[model samples]
Target: MLVNTFLPLPEFITGNILWLAKKGFAITLFLIGTDLSLKVIKTVGIKSVLFGVILWAFISILSFIVITVF
Candidate 1:
């Protein structure tokens, strides 16, 4: 954001570059999912995963309510 303060940047800077950078970022994030393996899932166990999902859902709902109200 700070760098973009220099906006309406010169013609040398184009949307194509930004588009390519965005795609690169998305591809990198997608590749990160490959690190999760079945062994890790088995190690953590389904019960633990269920508990985590429940906790996450609860927190998300609370946050949504709080943010919406205030």
Candidate 2:
């Protein structure tokens, strides 16, 4: 946003870059998903997964509270 205020990018260039970035991100996620397997999940164990879920929930709720309070 700041950069655009000083020297705005051409629409065509920004569009192309955004298109490329989206494609790259999709491909990266695809590769990562392909790498994940049941074996890996089994190794991580249910306990770890539950812990992660709880931690994520805690952080998300805390963030929401902070955002609303401020």
Tens digit of lDDT per residue, candidate 2, span 1-70? 4566698899897788789989999867964866855677699897876797699799999999999999
How big is the positional error of residue 49 in model 1, measured in Å on the Cα after superposition?
A: 0.7
User: Lowest summed lDDT over 10 consecutive residues: which window, candidate 1?
Assistant: 29-38
lDDT (CA) per prediction: 0.74, 0.81
Q: Candidate 1: lDDT of 27?
A: 58
User: In model 1, what are the clashing residue pairs, if there are any?
Assistant: none
Q: Per-residue lDDT for 1-70 in model 1, tens only?
A: 3455776665446566778889988856754764645576589898876797699799999999999999
Backbone clashes counted, model 1: 0
Model 2 ranges with Cα > 4 A deviation: 1-36
- For the record, the alpha-carbon RMSD of candidate 2 to the native fold, in angstroms, is 9.5
**Candidate 1 CA-lDDT value:** 0.74
TM-score of 2: 0.47
State model 2's lDDT: 0.81
- Worst 10 contiguous positions by lDDT, candidate 2: 30-39
